[model samples]
Target: MVTPPSYESRQFERRPGIRPRQTLGRRLDAASRAALPAAIAVVLLLLLHAPLGLPAQPALLLGAELACVFYWSLFLPRVMPSPVVFVLGLLVDLLGTGPLGLSVVLLLIAHVAGIAWRQALMRQGALVIWLVFAGVAALCCLIEWLATMLLEWRLLPPGSAALQFGFALGEYLVLSGPFAWCMRVVARPHG
Candidate 1:
């Protein structure tokens, strides 16, 4: 009589000594992956706020922050937690000499918006993602402009915020590919 296949003989069975838990090196790798977003934020802030002469410095800094925040929030929200976002925004505010909490509020709103949009898109193509990012970036710029005007109690020049938004869109488009590739490597589940 034919007997049932033994568990050890099954094709899908795991090999001996191979566990679901990763080795020490892999665990360290995963840890670094998790910390990458925060590290990148710190580095970006440092570079932007450095004393080097740069054109449109404030706008460039804001654009970089927005791109980094949006990319991480959309793809790897867990890696880019709210607290990290808050701290990054706070750093930008302190560095850029903007009103306290302005960047924080803007970043938090962007993070939420990104999460919502990512859910809707569900890993859709890059074009759709970029289109949605444009809308979100525009909204973020508006909110920031309104907040600045309200806090400072003065009307700002027209088209300033638009300029910032344009810079931010440029940053987003340029950085998305590199960030996406990094996320693919870092966010992958390790065995």
Candidate 2:
């Protein structure tokens, strides 16, 4: 007759002499990964309050846009949670003129799209990534314009939307490389 192994014997045999030190190291690594999004959020909030203005510009570059896209793509499955996206959008709406809740809704849509397409973009190069950022930025602009018109019942002229979209596309393209590099640096495994 064949005898079954004891529960204690089986458990010990599955993982022998795995020290608590190894477990602690893993926990620390996980904590480090989890901290990244919070760090990004704090930095973004600081930037929101910073005086990094471009004089004589009607439409200025906001760090929030870059922060949103970068954090969403880099930490899609973890850090950039839906609530964060919605809150970020609401914060942007409060800071800007386009109707309240408009930015929040637009951001939520963009974040959803980013999450859906993340895997496909991950394998591409920087230039392709920049192109993706441009597309997303354009979509954000479109959504904002649509939401404003729908809520306020004032049709924003096509020219205005085009101008705004152009400016955002340029801004996102300019910032994409730096943001992607920063995310890569942060995601690197520490020795």
Best by lDDT: 1
TM-score per candidate: 0.83, 0.66
lDDT of each: 0.81, 0.60
Candidate 2 TM-score, C-alpha based: 0.66
Determine the backbone clash count of candidate 1. 0
Give the poorly placed runs of model 2, Cα more than 4 Å off.
1-58, 61-67, 74-76
- What does candidate 2's lDDT look like per residue over 66-100, in tens digits? 43545455434455767776776676667666678
In terms of lDDT, model 2 sits at 0.60
